[model samples]
Target: MNVKSGSAFFLKVIAILIGIAVLAVCIYWLPAAARRDAIERPGDYSLYPLLVCAYGVCITFSVVLYQVFKLLTNIEKNNAFSELSLHSLKLIKKCAFAVIFFILLAIVYLKVLTQFTGDDPAGPISLGLMGILATSVVAAFMDVLQKPLKNVLDEQLKND
Candidate 1:
């Protein structure tokens, strides 16, 4: 597909919207659930670590989103589809790194929870972490596919 086409732009916009929704869920629902569970269980601050993990993921996702948007802006400024495709691939690479980091962080949090002796109340966080990991995997594949597209664009641009 043409990276500079309207469809690509539309997909990017959709991704941004999904990111926003995830952020909103993290900010509102995640905290309230953690707080409630903490209060109900009293003496079990286990949720704290999970909450922290969620926040960390949220922060990283925000950064990823910011970087992606910046990349999009830069791509839009380029005259050739090849240049834009390359920028998008780079952004996806960064996003994959961020996702992997967050997944590792989540795993660490889960391990810590298991060691501390308490309820595994961070189900939402764990689930969200998995979602991010899956997303990153897909994004990484896209970046890989973009390599050939970038080459094609480069050749086309050279001819022009």
Candidate 2:
């Protein structure tokens, strides 16, 4: 394979490794953390919603990773400037938005629970806001990339 394709392949491998790591954390670490919380708080903690939020975020992560893999494949095929790459970027952006949505929903749920349980929601809310900020940046980057790609595609059409 060529250098560019080799790099793309390396990146794809990295993405797959990241997916596996995230999956391990979600399947093992998250449940273990939940169990710890349960043991500490007994019946007072709301475990299900927390798990739902975590799993929801994990779903988004998988989607984004898949999209990244698609994008890398396009690059490997030397079609990084094609519509498929643009579409993959768009899908990644959507996944980022989904992450933000899930985090926000979790924050709202935790806020409601905190009111009755007397638990401080500041930490989680801050984390959610950070997630929102990160996703917003990703979406903006996708939007920026789309603009240039659209222009190039339009130019290509005009040339033809």
lDDT, candidates in the order shown = 0.71, 0.89
> Given candidate 1, what's the lDDT at residue 108?
77
- Measured by lDDT, the strongest candidate is 2
- Candidate 1 weakest ten by summed lDDT: 76-85
Q: Which prediction has the highest TM-score against the true structure?
A: 2
Q: lDDT tens digits, residues 32-138, model 2?
A: 99989988988966878878989999988998999999988888877988989888888888888888888988999999998988999899899889889988999
**Tens digit per residue, CA lDDT, model 1, 42-97:** 89876776677667667767766776665666566664355665766676677667
Q: What is the lDDT of candidate 2?
A: 0.89
TM-score of 1: 0.62
Q: What is the alpha-carbon lDDT of model 1 when measured against the actual structure?
A: 0.71
